[model samples]
Target: MDPRQEEQINAQVIAVFPDKVRIIVDDLEDFKIAEESLKVGSYVKIADNENAVLIAIIENFQIAVSAEGKRDHIIEAFPLGILRNGKFERGGDSLAIPPKEVQPATISDIKKIYEDSVPKEASFRFATLSSNISVPVPVNGDKFFNKHIAVVGSTGSGKSHTLATIIQKAVSEKGDGFSLNNSHVIIFDIHSEYKSAFPSANHIDISNLALPYWMLNSEELEEFFLDTEANDHNQRNIFKEAIIKDRLAKFSGSASEKQNIHLDTPILFDIREVLAYAIAKNEEMVNTGEVYASSNKEKAGQPKYTQGSLHGKLTNFVNRLENKLNDSRLNFFLGEQSMKITFEETLQKLLGYSSKSESNVTVIDLSGVPFEVLSITVSLISRLVFEYGYIYKRIRCAKNPNEKINNDIPILLVYEEAHKYVPNSDLSKYRASKVAIERIAKEGRKYGVTLLLASQRPSEISETIFSQCSNFIAMRLTNPADQGYVKKLLPDSLGSLIDKMTSFRQGEALLVGESIILPSIVQIEPCIHTPSSSDIPYWQLWKEEWKNMDFAAIKEEWYK
Candidate 1:
């Protein structure tokens, strides 16, 4: 039989709707083949007309026994798109087909579907179809990076490997040695797993990551220092006033007069001086009695002044401030040896824009940071990045209206374990980071900032943030709640396809949304430089021979 004639009518369409089609298979052998193809997530093509083919996925099936004892296989399919005139297209005005005109499509038709879906521009080849035919599955580079994306899966489902693959492919050069020179990607590495993966990238851990105390605004300071619910209003006001005064005193005469300083101004100030001023104000006496003459000439006539009304109110506040200043764990915020580093220097260091380095990727390792201050640290860094991008774009656009902007300093902010910071519950402890990240999700694209959030528990992440993601790389998710959460975020037409997510093999994922021409299940390629996210060898360690313990070294480090 000629292959072109294989498009001849094989199955008869018994029912049809706008979104679904039902076909009948009467031939015993053909019924078996159609039954095999009806498995969920498997694709099949229906002949919509002489030249147009309708691609659909088998979502369900039923076996019917007629009164004459003959068996009929009914296959229910969800239409994905229309392949017409040798081109695969979606959402066109001519997808609907009349009933009884459909025919079963052949393997040659499937090949055409894959070929027409390959992106025309620069793309990253992630996987091949499981059919062993080596059909190239490519994701458009521009759409994947410019839009916010989410990577969610259960543990050991290859989420880390997927992320590493994306980053490696992004930073690596093309065959022609063409690289993205202006791309800046910052990974918030919670487990310190990515430092080894990108050896050439700029890596900053808690040991060297410095965020001066003055960088925090009034609201952040309040969140960190004052227990607003517990602290007295008078004491809080005193602290605020002292901070304002110390910030203003950083500038002198002409500069001070011209500068408009707010509570959130980034300026160097001696924290000790602020503490001392607050203490002095608290200790100042107020006259409770009328003026009186003293017997001694040196005393002359003076009205006795009692201790200030706020003397004892600030004792606890002062003690808490002193403790934070002395704690070595907080050295990142308080251990600046000199006040000479300007705000511009701080921005350059945090944004990885200093003159010493031209590398575009910066990985911030958060493993060493104390848990008490982790939320604020993440909040401060994220807010600074957003603000810098926002201001830089405004200034550039104002300077040259017709300038060709190639996204010179566009930043891709990747957050691992995103649910910890952007939880759905309003009672979460990391409110600061949650608000900052949510702002970026809603409006960051306008300023060349995009987010790639990775989380194991998609249900726990903020709905606003998750819903705003335009792309998703969903790996195996077994938990019902997590699976349901991902399903809710996708379009109704893809729900049956998403149902297979729980059973996907490790390293296999469904890449959907704006990044690809079609929703596909891709086998993610292994990263050349893999992260240290593999499970520990517990059995191997248990089988090892006993060795001498280093008690002395352990004790010394523990004391330090």
Candidate 2:
């Protein structure tokens, strides 16, 4: 290189540490150039020696007057990884290089560094760097997704678009011949927005998404069917006994099998029959002209029948149960007419691989579902998927001990508006879904089940769940609380990047963690089929002439 070019690139390393470097900018012209080029979160390379290059990020900068009253501009950077020879090694060793050895990395230098650092296998080109030169950022798909991931941003910050892009890219076969035939992704579509994104995806709304009523465990049943706070102890016991008796009779088999039927058993049983038994027990009378206590084990000392102490107490409970049974909105659970369909069939419908003609992505739209039973519904579906995946992996592992575990068909479960279900607050009302999802977040990876959690409020999400995530795609989060939550989740080395979240564009995100070689700002590629979450054009709609309103039809639909 020429003397002038070398001098232009060279900068003085004022101070150095294991993970960070402090550079001093003295030349006015060079400082101006550095100010323009070395942006926060931008990559830089420092020459440790002729054979080794230390890569770092410009985290912060300061302008101050030195002891001699001379102006000084200092750039603080955190070392990402060291590139030695042609290979990339994580972390940097203590270097004794004198001042003026550090060089401001050029675009070509960065390209070479990224090309050598990013692995070829198990990686995909997803986004490009928003820099002077357009450089494709190849991410390790396996590493990014194998561990849990969180995609969080405020409203209108491209959270939905970023998620859609990821799904589209995963299922897209146009480039790299990536086949999603074996990929099983179930999206819990909260607002019915993603139905059109993947035309080949299996779209399941409340109309066709039937969750067998018997799938609810005891806690879920209590949460949905009986109001524990309102119901007395005897009423709850009577309800539990009826459920056990009905489930045992429905799944009658060998003596050993009958022993397995408990209150929480996931067996197909008529909910109406259980309700009838409970009512009958509530109405049953004994010889003492009193209510019969079916749950009372001490027969000798018990009042034979005192008009069934639970008769009046259970009226509200029975009324609630009846209301739920009759609710058309809850037909997904109560309207299962196909008695021939077994649990295996339901599992296949929920988790089966979609062929080329079929849709691989199954979106469970919860928009039409009633709010009261929404949590239990989500719990049932999430629990079923987790249990099925857990059992499948165990059986597969037992059958072929020598086979690789990754060979199993992986399922990616996407939870939209996750904060509604998995809140960090201990007093959250939705415990059923929270517990189910937390179990998956903690243990799903071993069984080939991954989670993609998208939320508008990171501060509201469960800390345990958020902490497990290995990759983060954070967009423009203006809220200070949200930004602080994200900052706490990130490592100290990359915490400065969180400050830039407020300025990110719609589709731009800070990609960090196990996915990329280093934390970077990426312009995510546009999804081919956008979701139905676009903002409403209020101005345009207001300017247009109003059409004739259908008052009668609107009223009738509202009543329905």
Model 2 lowest lDDT segment of ten: 28-37
lDDT of 1: 0.76
- RMSD (CA, Å), each prediction: 3.5, 5.3
TM-scores, each model vs. reference: 0.88, 0.88
Every candidate's lDDT? 0.76, 0.76
Off by over 4 Å in 1: 1-9, 17-19, 27-41, 60-73, 91-94, 99-119, 130-133, 173-180, 253-259, 286-303, 337-341, 354-356, 403-407, 546-559
- List, residue by residue over 222-337, the lDDT tens digit for candidate 1: 77776655757876788778887887776664775636776787666777887798778767789867665666567557777787878777888888788888888888777773
What is the lDDT, from 0 to 100, of the residue 350 in candidate 1?
A: 64
Candidate 2 yields a Cα-based lDDT of 0.76
Q: What is the lDDT of residue 8 in candidate 2?
A: 52
User: Pairs clashing in candidate 1?
Assistant: none
Model 1 CA lDDT for position 124: 63
Q: Write the per-residue lDDT of candidate 2 for residues 145-207, one digit (tens) a residue.
A: 788889998999888877888888777634455544466788988888898887778877877
